[model samples]
Target: MSKTSQDEWTLEIKPVSGWFHFHLKDVWRYRDLLMMFVRRDFVAVYKQTILGPFWFFLQPILTTITFTVVFGNIARISTDGIPPLLFYMSGIVSWGYFSDCLTRTSSTFITNANIFGKVYFPRLVSPLSNIISLLMKFGIQLFLFTCFLLYYWMNGSTNVHPNIYILLTPYLLILMAGLGLGFGIIVSSLTTKYRDFSFLVGFGVQLLMYATPVIYPLSALPEKYKWIVLANPMTAIIDTFRYAFLGAGTFNPGNLIYSSVFMIVTLSIGILMFNRVEKTFMDTV
Candidate 1:
């Protein structure tokens, strides 16, 4: 066969994927829609709220105060020798970013069934936009955390200083985004098949949080449960958050690497499944 004939006769075949079938270039072509969805999320979130985005700052502040009193003052849990407010806030801010992302992204398919059915933009854009919107909230919470950090640095016993490992902050944020998006996509995909999953998302995420290392330090866990705790990737993420700001954490760099690998695996798998499901989800969903 000549080169021209081979080119002209090339057969079209359905795609098969082992893991990732990233449509990065295709996603780029739809970047405008991504921004539109992001704006839509932000605008719709506080369309009629009294305090608007200001509520973002209030939520985490009140949460940290409550946790500090109830868990630290009342329950007397250790903070690895760091101040209670700072310790809990570090965990809260990061966990809030992740859990909030998961909660919102979990609604990706069901929430946008009409849009997905009507439109042709990349479905990944929906969750990606929601994560960006969630990141704005995370940034606000982090600003509050920084203020608390400065307060402790000025007057509290907290030798508030970040380690060289603090440079991993961006990677940590990416890990959080990846885990939320990846896990949420998987759940959304299942929800299409099993109606029970809609209820499970909220309940499951709550129960899952207990397994994560948010309320207490990883060291506080019993030796037997250590493996179970570390098995949760959020454990590494939470500990790394503490390690970055308060220097009161014992995160292994190796574990962080493991978490990074796990996050990439999760996101890649999620994207692949989501792409597959979106094609036929309308009938089932």
Candidate 2:
């Protein structure tokens, strides 16, 4: 090649500088890679399983049944006047999506270290893909919840009352995705150096579920202790979802606003930390 032609070629590779160099545009440019990763994640989970995608429906169904038997029937926990089946199913479906995104994406760096080491694509793609893939799974589970909802509604259940708050479903989903991706990447970034955080994630998530009122309504909490549960951002989400669908839970606009703000802050901090870590994570990983 001529010197002039060689001079015309340019390819620059440099270390990420700023704390917020997320390269979101690069994520857009590599949309195809994002989708590919999404597809791989979605299929890989159930690849060799006998029931395949059917497990999506099966999981929530079984979980709701157990909650109904253990919490509703045995312990006689209050579901805020909502039927056991519908109440438990609603919380299961909502929390399941958020937790799945959190758990799966928390391993982003560790699970895809080899690829990150070799590839030039945006590292954000990995976690973003996880959110997308999990969204698909969440959709399936939501459909199952909807079917149960329809059955109860058609059966003339006096308690079932779908309200205008249902319109917030899409916005509520975004809040879930944002919170999960934010927490997941933050933990993933930390796990590069301290593997203990990864171990804590599972235990922490389970404890978090109990704190978030998955089995009982927020109203069931003691007045003094209620503030503690209200402090959890997910508390508003679960309650709002139930209120929207079954019209049987507390709904405070102030709480929802608090959650939205929390999501924004968490996501901003998580992305900055993630961008900072990706630059030197190979050394630690």
Candidate 3:
């Protein structure tokens, strides 16, 4: 081939040396592949299911009812004067998105090994696609929550008070997505070497939810125990989300700042480790 043709045909593969090096530009170049993966994830999940996407609505509603009965009535946990249904739904929807992203993305390496070995694309694309797919599900559940909010509003319930803080919803989601994607890719990378870690992800996420302020308001916790929950990066996001929509729970700017910093650090580390693992994961996986 001529010099120009040879240059056009040449493909260079370089070893990743430094910890901080990431080809984000390359990932952006393959955005079409990312979208394809997202479509596949969204469609494949509901393809054979009877209810299809309706399951998204059903899952949260049923869980809310169960929580209202068990936690609200049985345990008598305070909802900070907000209605029990709205209180639990707010926490549920936020927690559900974060958990779904974490759990699904954590298995990217193992689940997509066949494709990874067969073709070349940004390995991060799989997990990123999972995050996008979960966002879609979160939107549907959020709509359901809004419907309930409107119902309570029309009923003239003075207890349910939404405020300007509700504007933080987008930022809250970005934080959650960062945390989930960060923690998830880290776990996914580790699991390739030790399969035992896979079993713990589900159990660990369940335990982590209780550690977050999902079932009860953060304000209800005694002062001594408050710091323990605050240590979790998710606690602040969930607390602020509840406070914004329902006008209940602690809304500390300091906590939100801490959570944001934690997310950035975790995501940076996660991407670093993910880059290292992707180079050799196929061999061990």
Candidate 4:
């Protein structure tokens, strides 16, 4: 055999060893498949629906209105002097992105069981695709939120003071995505064995929103209870987002650092668990 021919024919397939051995290179090699899955998730979601992608815009809008009424009017939650509409919309947009990513990615194994069983590709692609699709949905909701922000700004709403902290918006988004993807994959991996976790995810995410600073400002929390809310990694991300756009929430560097560290740790653990589960989830699932 010629050297060139032997080299051209070289192929390696080895069993993964250790918990940290994520074949990221393989995932990169299957990038096209990842995009395909992303497109599939995006289209299949609204495929027979009357409104289609409009639901992206409508869901946040409706939720913002409901929060404005319930939390703003009824409970009289302080929005830290920002207009209730804008305040709630900001929270809704940020929280919605995280929640949507987490919820969708959490079902990777069960939803794609048949495909996983029939084919061999990087399993991470499935959840990564969900993150990308949810990002698209987040973009639509963000556009709607920007429209409201502009309307309020033009209307001379003094309470809505967008600041230079808005520069952190991109970082905030990346953190939110990391946290969602991390926690989601963890849950998805576990749900393969314990199906009940799937049922609990919905309820957990709903309760999680309250823990996160979604409807209310971090400043509104009394000093004694503030530490409790800060314990949630999402607290800093959402608070920073609100402060950036509305200039009405707390923006502690310590909190952001903590959230970033938590995201890294959670994502590391989630990926490890996912890698472990993907090898044998078919049998258990």
| Winner by TM-score between candidate 3 and candidate 1 | 3
Clashing pairs for predicted structure model 4, backbone only: none
How do these models rank on TM-score, best leading?
Answer: 3, 2, 4, 1
TM-score of 4: 0.94
Tally clashes: model 4. 0
> What C-alpha root-mean-square deviation, in Å, does candidate 4 show against the real structure?
2.5
Task: Write the residue-wise lDDT of candidate 3 on 82-127 in tens digits.
Answer: 9999999999999999999899999999999999999988899889
Give me the overall lDDT of model 1.
0.84
Name the runs in model 1 displaced over 4 angstroms: 1-22
Model 1 lDDT, residue 179, Cα: 95
Q: Stretches of candidate 2 above 4 Å error?
A: 1-11
Question: Which ten contiguous residues of candidate 2 have the minimum total lDDT?
Answer: 1-10
Relative to the unseen true structure, what is the C-alpha lDDT of residue 16 in candidate 1, on a scale of 0 to 100? Answer: 53
For 122-228, candidate 1 gives per-residue lDDT tens digits of 78888899999888888888888988798778875546777787788888999999999998888787787776877888988888788887888888889998898
What's the CA RMSD for each of the models? 3.4, 2.1, 2.0, 2.5
The Cα error of candidate 4 at residue 255, in Å, is 0.8
Report the error of model 1 at residue 4, Å.
Answer: 16
Q: Per-residue alpha-carbon lDDT of model 2 for 127-230, expressed as tens digits? A: 99999998998889888888999999999999999899999998899999999999999999999999999999999999999999789998899998888899
lDDT of each: 0.84, 0.91, 0.93, 0.90
- Tell me the TM-score of each prediction against the true structure: 0.91, 0.95, 0.95, 0.94
| TM-score of model 1 (CA atoms) | 0.91
Compose the digit string of candidate 4's lDDT tens values, residues 1-285: 345654575565556567877869999999999999889888799998999999888898898889999999999999889999988998889998899889988999999999999999989999999888888988888888888898989999888888999889889989999999999999999999999989989999999999888988887888998878889999999999888888887789999999999999999999999999998899999
Worst 10 residues of 3 by lDDT: 1-10
